[model samples]
Target: MAHWDPRGQVAPHVRRQVASLAAAVDELVVVSTADLDDDGAAFLGRHGRLLRRTNYGYDFFSYKTGLEASRPEDFDEVVVCNDTYVPLVGYGEVFEAMAGRPADFWGLTASQRVHPHVQSFFVAFRPWLVGSQAFRGFWGRMSPVSDRASVIAEYEVGLSRTLTDGGFRFASYYTETDADRALAQRRVAWWTLHRLPPPRRRREWEFLKARSKDPWNPAIALADVALAPSPPRPAGARLPYLKIDTLRYDPYGLGAERLLRLAERRRPEELAGVREYLAATAPLSAARPDTDLRPTPVGVRPLRRLVEYGRAA
Candidate 1:
């Protein structure tokens, strides 16, 4: 969840959405920052089986922390969600879509023009893909977003390139333009010797915000919320048949059954024996992602050292 720093009325709404989502899943793990107050903590405790909080950072750092927290062992599938989205139905469908793929690569619900970068209402993790030190390091390097727009675009492009280089496909349930809207809003929060004059700063923020044409002020929604497609799959990308095995319920014979139902566009519950079939399967593994990469030193010292070595050589 990319949480705002101050506590306010937003807390109650965020809590309700989370509670509803937790009830739908078999096991839930909630990760947030210290910004969550007593009410937030109590709400989360009731819904999540496990809860973790990290160092407070802005939207960028908080997002990076969540990425780092995901492990191959936590669940067969990991769903990354922004706090703003309220899941109306089972997200199990997403995992079912990504079933049998590598764990490291992400399965996302995509939006038009703007790819779902900073926040995704739905993302699924495959285990094998996530087990690489290189992948984790790649994400770690993206911490503390310097430029929101460019950072988002570059990360998605770079991520796609890296995954393709490593021989993996990025999958998405595409969304249309009408389903999403984005707005930008900036105001002078501080002044400094190097900063622009107040009038100029205000004008700049106003122009950008207007040009973006967001449905509401960017601060109101944090430019993260979007309408999830009903049935959750967009046109033209539907497979002939895709199985959505409920890992929590049916583990054994459901794969074949799921495949059969998917072919017919039928929900599993509509089938006669699926419920019984799912109840008998055992839980899957919960393993951590590989973290073997050497951490990169922060700042220009490493670059300076490299330059010195090159000159000496």
Candidate 2:
């Protein structure tokens, strides 16, 4: 299952991602937040089912709708993912690896910032989990929410706790480690001091501290580790923070380009639809200018320096 917002016309990149996922799964169901444009509808028609709905509750609602449309007994496993990521490397291999793992539910990554939960971006639930009363109950408890923070708190964080309390087990492709926590903390400091602005920095810093005891942000850390070279290390290994402000800053298309090259070399057929998309959406500039880098505020500078030293060491 994939949740999308056509926005206007669905980008070629999104279509390509959907097509890639379609190739990997037995059935592909797309729940769109808005009606698809003709091109979007036509492209998805070739790949899978596309259902349009009001953009009310965000991905969680779309996820519920998709689950409602499918019967648990009909499929051995079901995956729910959103279109924020492009599978650059072994999309198949990741699933194959998870298939051998014995867990009721699993995702490509996990976060332990506030509470441990499998990041919902690409999670797979076995039929056992899918059919569980707990599973159904979780969705049943959902209320319509358009706020990102509310979704994160009530759904993303709440889901893991709900399921675990119900005696359902979970796992992640990337496990949490002490090293990961240590590195994450350092990165958090770096991001707060160097990346954010004066007015917002303190607030973001406090939020980061409250949500994560560690230094690094989980989402940013996940991207860093997942996109690393072969023999990938755990999240927050050596991967630098990649600012994820959509088009405002990206890593010069390094991750996507790497994936494209890998696809061209090994899965040429899979590269067809994405070629035009990648060409059209290539990053228009180099990395965002770093002229804004500044020292932390007087009260915070010493603490920031301590973290910077720890990261360096």
Model 2 lDDT tens row, 129-207: 8888988899988899867677878888788889899998888765645765665665555555454555557787587
Task: Give a tens-digit lDDT track for model 1, residues 1-313.
Answer: 4443233113433554466557655555566655566666676667764344564333445545666655544565545555533232334444555565433455344322343231233455455556655556666667444553554565644555555567655555422233222111111111010132223577776754444342322111111122222334444222111112222212111123323334224333223333333343223212212211222224322342222101110
Window of ten residues with lowest summed lDDT in model 1: 185-194
**Candidate 1 to native Cα RMSD, angstroms:** 20.3
Candidate 2 — which residues are off by over 4 angstroms?
176-181, 192-216, 233-313
TM-score of 2: 0.71
Per-model CA lDDT versus the true structure = 0.39, 0.62
Runs in model 1 lying further than 4 Å from the true structure: 8-13, 24-27, 49-60, 63-70, 97-108, 111-121, 154-158, 175-313
**lDDT, residue 96, model 2:** 70
Model 2: worst 10 consecutive residues (lDDT sum)? 245-254
- lDDT for model 1 comes to 0.39
